[model samples]
Target: MSDAVKRLAIRDRIAVLDVLRGLAILLILLMNIPAMGNLESARIDVTGWTAADQMATWLQRVIFAGTQRGMLELLFGAGMLIMASRAMQPDGPVAVADAYYRRNLWLVVFGLAHALLFMWWGEILFPYGLAALLIFQFRTLAPRTLMGIGLVVLLASGHWFGTQQYNARQQLLHDAPAALAIKAEGNPLSDDQSATVKRWEDLQASTKGTGKETQEERTGRTTTLAAFFKWNAKFWMGFTSDLLVLIIFEASATMLIGAALFKWGIIQGKRSARFYLALMLCAYAVAIPMRVIDTQQYMTLALDPRPGWITYQISRLAMTLGHLALVNLAISTGVGRWLLKPFEAAGRLPLSVYFGQSIICLWILFPPYGFGLWGKFGMAGMTAIAVGVIAFQVIVANLWLRWFENGPFEWLWKSLAYAKLQPFRKTPSAIHITAPI
Candidate 1:
């Protein structure tokens, strides 16, 4: 077969991969949902919540937050390997890097637009683009070397983040006595605070940052814009510098592992039940509980660094490693595969699905939007709503993919990336399913 045909044709289990991706989507929501405070408050700190709220926060942090992002990172790494392998056959590393880099660049544009247009700021695509740009230059690196780089980046990033958090906490605590006391009353916002909050909300509602200079002009001319940049810069650093360093490292490692798995035929549904079962046992048995312990301990002192910060930081690494192990086990087990099926198709178009979810969520919660249900939905209610949202997404994903090759946003981004239109709708003739089922 020609190279183009080969590039277009590879034996991949769409069902299995999709399912895993879907689970990731749901798990991400599980992890992030609590970050949205209840109806009255725009904060996500569910620290001192009670009963259902407390249980939800703790359980989610332990199970979903600890494990889900790692799984996604691994999957992304695996995907890179798959793409890299395909790009390598005819030309060389340079060719593969070029193709992937273009894809990532497009992804960055999409992410920036998505973040500005939608209310969600925790977009992963932006950093993934940055990582891809850097990693593309190292396409020829030995896998071991790549892993080392990933580790170094991960550790350095973690140290930076932890240190920043430590310092920030100290400062917050130093200022807290007065700030907390003043804000401790039933009404959390001061008169000035309430006005500032309202103005910010109004700005967010109206600004999508699409028109060339319109949004920028408005923001540039106002004090709110300055405040926005200041607050946002800090927010970006927290995630990008610290948390993302770990996430990126984990992703790079997982990608290498995925490449190895593909080469060895494990990801092609070729691994034996025994191997998978063993993987599950090893990863879950020793990892999950340890992660749970670490997460609770870490969260307990997140706002205010405690005396045992050093020990807690060490434990966080342990927890992260445990989560990685769990994700590996999950990949091996048929459970993740089965659980992910409905959402997998959607995950293929992550940009679309993620943004769609944001639109729905914001419409539901934002005051100027639909139901205005943010702070009102307590732990149980939000949990239920989140579940409901997932179910809806599954239905939507299934319906959309049945007729379309790419999700709406996915098609747009890909079209822009390639500088040409590609297939979007799945016609009967265009659909290609392997035979001998």
Candidate 2:
């Protein structure tokens, strides 16, 4: 590699951005535990719950639900910009495209392994990697253009997906009565009718699961790795279509906005306190209430499983941007650096911390071989565990950063991405660290 490429490789890591990413990871843990611990209860299944469970579920849906994922999407876009902004042509040992594409391809590999091996289908690495490949070129776009195009894409996606879902439910609503009537009259249902009825039933299963289905899932997941792998693979195939939608449009839209923000220098804590304060207030004012209404709609959705007119994407963008503004405001105002300091270290190792979460929950905490805690807790209990896991990661991340330049998984990823041996210690070195994941 040339001296320029080498120097670019070791540019000093940004602190405030790392802090923001670290905080996003911690909040993601809070939002993710319900799904990580019990797949059945990841939706609206509140079976065998307590008052605490109800309250926890309410709190998560109202405030912390989609925002965490949104924040990560924003950060991912910014990080991709920093990486992809370098030399575009194959100039040296590490061309920008080679390193960047290689890095994200490894992320795809990691994501697939995380889901199939760790049994966490909700993992974002795979999709984030996919979105990264598509959005990296937007790094050079003007901030306003990126934001404008992103907003259009986001709203359009919400409208299209929501309408499609609504139409499917409408079809089922039309077909069900006719199908039942025909069956009752001793005639078989048509193919479209049968498909509509099945879709209707799947919608029911999505919101609330029967105890029998939950038990069967838990048994399949916890019995053995080979069995769980086969089951997980099959299950993933069932939802690959929705996953593709999320990858191609929804995540890409949010990421575009993130790149715009980064282009404007807002994500680097360069914005004024007043500016961020106003942003946070306005975003939250719009989003929190929207989420409350969305929650109520979901509650009723169990009975009416059709997708209705909703602000799913709008609320998510508002809330996620609200969090971005809030964090930058706190940093710019210097009001909470003490609390945010440890997160700096935590953020630097986002790759390790993120994948580590799956290892902790899926590999050790929830599996039958470890604690066998899968499907044992409701939302409240699972959330409590998530909190503990977050604490553990934060403490360990700080300590790990003291002696090492990167977490273990980070070391591996960097090595593979750059196609070179990356320095891994905190000692004085000729190289700098890669940006946060």
Best TM-score goes to which candidate? 2
Candidate 1 accuracy as TM-score: 0.71
Off by over 4 Å in 1: 1-15, 36-48, 89-95, 139-145, 163-270, 298-340, 432-437
Q: What C-alpha lDDT values do all the predictions have?
A: 0.55, 0.75
| Error in Å for residue 69 of model 1 | 2.4
> Candidate 2 — number of clashing residue pairs?
1
- Candidate 1: which pairs clash? 18-344, 19-340, 19-341, 38-374, 38-375, 39-374, 39-375, 39-376, 40-375, 77-255
What is candidate 2's local distance difference test score?
A: 0.75
User: Residues 202-225, candidate 2, lDDT per residue (tens digit)?
Assistant: 656656675444555666677987
Predicted candidate 1 versus true structure: per-residue lDDT over 174-271, tens digit per residue? 65455445555655766655554444344333333233233342232233434434433444455466566555554554444444444555443455
